[model samples]
Target: MVTEYESALEVAERLNRLTPGEFEKRTGLFSTGAEAVENAVKIARTWTGRDAIVVLGHAYHGRTLLTMTMTGKNVPYKEGFGPFAPEVYRVPSPYPYRWAGAATTETGIAEEAFEQLVDQITTQVGTANVAAIIVEPVQGEGGFIVLPEGYMTKVAQFAKENGIVFIADEIQAGLARTGDLFAVDHEGVVPDIVLTAKALAAGMPLSAVTGRAEIMDSVRAGGLGGTYAGNPVACAAAIAALDVIVDEDLPGRARHIEEVVMPRLKELQAECAAIGDVRGRGAMLAMEFVVPGTRTPDPDAAKKVAAHANARGVLTLTAGTYSNVIRLLPPLVISDDLLEDALDVLAEATRTLA
Candidate 1:
């Protein structure tokens, strides 16, 4: 067993506080989101004695070997990274914006997507060999594609029925990013394992895999550890940061950000046909750029819009498999005035192209 530090214990306690008595909570701290994600997969594989893992299209887990293999995008993340780890499978992403204006709501589209995934699993990868179904409640690097209502619940139920460990890769959406402590909370879905990082420690290099006792403890002694996994300084920072999340009501702040910014984004979308879609919740939001009057992705427009926003002191990121999505990831703590100011700049930028 790895020697436990006091701060690490405190950090675990703080994280557990979010789900009091929900499960026998055990957390393994790591220095990066990739490490936490990879460890969670390891735990799932060990506990279930299975090998295959499932991920959704447009998903972005991380850059490590196993995590990158789990990721669904190619190009910068997986290109030339070759001979990747095996046993990772892909599913259709319920991305409504790009669903070709199908005769379905987001919920309907999600049902179809899951059905396709089930078919693939049954045919391509034996269902019994599946170890986990990992998802980000909101796709981040994949352009903040929020899962439709009931989609996460459906996935959770499937995992339960199949005895598959369900993981919420909340590294980007948890900790009040979506106006909820965890994005899955909005869907009332409780994953077997939740990987957290990014905002967890107020920017400190700390990530964690918190899960059920049985699965976490199933690993043999010495199965999980790193020389700097749970560095005391980072753990201490995480503790304080978690406190701030509670004391300052960061979750509520996130909601406030959504309330203040979402309408403005929608209004901006009304004025620009190039804005193929505007989505996301709380401080994490996005706008997908497409050719005017068509859904064909326009990476040039996305790049130009981001450049314009950046020139005006509003930072943005281009995302998605086609890189035609400009994602808005403003700080949750941004004041209403500042957030609006940034949005105003973005609005002007979009209009310049409109």
Candidate 2:
């Protein structure tokens, strides 16, 4: 087991070299994504002097009490777990596949509609007491929904103008998984705080919350830290992972995954009317299952598709509050041949479902 007391400073130093912008001015790392999120909220509360946090629909932050309240989809996770952290509110996610017409024609998917929902929540919740508006740039558990292109910028602007911290939950899609160091980077928007994890240490367990210095510093010195927050072994692995990402050009690899998988997914869409949507960014892809000849979500079909793929030696996961979305999370190190093989399995699974 990786020692909890190991030094992560060296790894953080090296990560600074790989993606210098993320922590160019930061001084430390975090233990897990959950810890990072907790700290991010604490800092936001401090910065805005607000006690409430608002998150978008279908989000999955972590399993901690605070996170469970922020998680939009409840099934195996939030069930029987109540009396969660207070002041945690949920709003609609501008998921085009599910939330139709949320984007404008000129601006793309109606992110403004999402922002309007946030605005309404802020007004109702009393913006003065709202500390932050948290969201996943690409909703991971919500069917790999990519927010409209300009949504992040507009949301950030709204938050700033309203004195609310804007946090981007990039835990699942960051660390170069989406062809950019961070998914928010794709939209050219800077978040007050960016939460990262999962692929950051490759297979190691490490997560972080990097943000503007002022907001991060607002938390008292003793307020944001943990015993194993920056464990050395995970740090070392994370440093190595960052190096691999840059040296092996995994961002390009992610783009390649998108290129290879999208066509096949689209083909599946064409062949099967039961496939409702083909969406995602870079390597994080998903297909929404639906009733044949209708848009009604068919989670039962999705389960069959996943079981068929697993039986064929390809592991798959299901997401979405309805559990009708099939998600693909192959390692970035997967070979092109293997990638193609996995896609074939997925296609075959889709056919079986059809």
Candidate 3:
């Protein structure tokens, strides 16, 4: 039984300190990732006086109407949820492993694909009416797809040039989950608006939309806020979580997890023929399961591996539009030995399924 009189402002102030010297940002709190995203779009549309938004293929924004329309997958997230919000558009994401014409290496397609994406958006949506372009720096439910190098910078530039807000949906990859306070930090790309949740309040149902002051202030006073939008209890938890992330150097911990997990997953990829790709950054990693000797997605194999891991006391999750990617989102504070043990279980599951 928490009251509204707690400390939402205090938490916002602390979050403000987390990323100093970048953008002069103001923070708004929400009860879930979806709320933050929905509000972000409102703010973007209000600021730009536009009606259209651009999203990428295989993205997972949230399950609400607008966010679901913004999402790319159809099976569980958007199966029967139509008729969706209007004026939302989708474009191709640079998934290195699956880009048709590009080299299928760890570093996937580059400038050519980016230019093509821009062309597609410009041709299809016409940049003048676009309010924002939202993207997940690391596609979470889309199988941990890390944007190719230079992709973020180019997208941000395009958004700025077009007067469209660039909103980075960091719900699943922010708050030190990706070896940085935000995944966009890795590439030195600054977004006009950033939506964060999942790990923000130490598992509490708290999310935030932090952005350039002008963009954030564009919304009318009553246009933002819900009854529990910034509940004080969740804010308190978020404050404590922020302290731990900074004081304990959790971003460094995430990097250490990447160093420990990536190699192991890669070795497993070498041994497991069903593994089509291994990619991600920091602790937000995943392996895409494909048919042996082919690029066909093998969702069945992913299911089997996840089931096996679960039965063995290692809970796992499957992602991707095709449901063939096994994502590893270990906690940032997980002990190395425990993580290694979990990896061992995952390796065994991969081998057994293969």
Compare the candidates by TM-score and give the number of the best one: 1
Residue 95 local lDDT, model 2: 73
Model 2: lDDT to the true structure: 0.80
Weakest lDDT window of 10 consecutive positions for candidate 1: 14-23
**TM-score, predicted candidate 2 vs. hidden true structure:** 0.92
TM-score ranking, best first: 1, 3, 2
Task: List the pairs of residues colliding in candidate 2.
Answer: 6-232, 102-110, 103-109, 103-110
Whole-model lDDT values for every prediction: 0.88, 0.80, 0.88
Name the lDDT value of residue 42 in candidate 2.
Answer: 85
Candidate topping lDDT = 1
TM-score against native, each model: 0.97, 0.92, 0.96
- Taking the tens digit of each residue's C-alpha lDDT, what string does model 2 give over 1-354? 234344476665454444324544343477677777888888888888889898888888888999888988788779899978898877777777665653435266555655566677757787777899888888888778888777777778878888888888888988878878778878887777777777878767788776766777777767767777787778878878887888998888888889888899999999999899888889999999999888898999999999999999999999988899999987877999999999999989888877
Our tally of clashes for model 2 stands at 4
- Model 1 clash pairs are none
lDDT of 1 by residue, 1-354 (tens): 167899998888777668423877898899999999999999999999999999998899999899889888888999999899989999888888876435379878888877877889889998899999999999998988998888888888989999899999999999998998888888889889999998888899999999988999999988998888888988888888888888999889988988888898889889999988989987788888999898898999999999999998898889988899998878877887898899889989999999
